[model samples]
Target: MIEPASYSATEVLRDGRTIEIRALRPQDQQALISALDRSSPQSIFRRFLGARHHFTEQEISYFVNVDFVHHVALVAVADENGKPVVIGGGRYIVIPRTAKAELAFAVVDQYQRQGIGAALMRHLVILAHNAGLEELVADVLASNTAMLKLFENTGLSMSTTRESEIVHVALGLSLPA
Candidate 1:
């Protein structure tokens, strides 16, 4: 049985619109898959960095099964007639060897630049810090200017490079004391 997560509600304003951000729950899988499937091929490629389309069942199951101890995932959503629609999501994987983790996120095309991505990133940063992670890293395509800007706006120290037309980025997190 998939259980719903209890997340404190929060909102962000972008382009004169409001979006709600919160933690991911198992119940969100269907909505997430639907949004990802509907995403444009270019957007999907930028997010996943490959021409290989479609998320495998095993990947979906793993994303939906994360716990606070090992992983943290959050989603941004909008409610229409009481039905939740996923607009964006963020996740971090904690590396046991060193208190660091890799982060990833995506906002639906319609929701891009609407503060959904920024909110999700902020949420994940806090989650990672609280979970004892000292740094968060992301591997983004060099052409992904929007994502690059989002990371820059977070005020974290970052390094980037262009390798074969792909930009790789890394950000160090400063956990609040």
Candidate 2:
């Protein structure tokens, strides 16, 4: 099991830019809020399924504080003009009585398509495996091709079902060989 401590790693993007990935912490509240606020309306809608342009204090607080056992959150930070900025984030909340969890990811508009979301997802997958989770699930909009492709590239055979406007993807955590 991963220790209940902040983990860090460096990932190289498709364009060869590097980013720092670390466990999300309470101190990241402002950075997290800033990234979400600066995201495009369409990006916000794609992530939250609505035009949630503003984040409440309670919501920000809840997202930053993770237990790392049943709840795990990671952030991808990039230095912009010498200051670290939150560009992307990924997290999963465990389902009760099962080795499964619901996963989510969001990357700022300017950072999209740079593999930030995929890197965050990669870290989340490792955290899930170390935590002994068996499956990771996500409910993404059918039109969110970027996110859909990121999930698909996990290399695990995913079972997908479409209902209404939501596409549910289930990936078994056999921990991609």
Candidate 1 weakest lDDT stretch, 10 residues? 1-10
Stretches of candidate 2 off by over 4 Å are 175-177
lDDT agreement of model 1 with the native:
0.77
**Decoy 2 TM-score against native:** 0.95
All candidates: TM-score: 0.88, 0.95
- Computed on alpha carbons, the lDDT of every model, listed in order, comes to 0.77, 0.88
Candidate 2, residues 30-134, lDDT tens digits: the string is 899889888898998998888885777788778988888878888899989998899989899999999999999889999899989888888888888888888
Candidate 2 lDDT for residue 103: 96
Candidate 1, 164: how far from true, in Å? Answer: 2.2
For candidate 2, which ten residues in a row score worst on lDDT? Answer: 1-10
| Residue-level lDDT tens digits of model 1 in 1-177 | 112244545785666656677778888889889889767888888877877477789999998877856787788888757877887788888877988888888777877777888888877776666666778877888788888899999988788877897776778777335
- Badly placed stretches (over 4 Å) of model 1 are 1-5, 175-177
> Which is the leading candidate under lDDT?
2
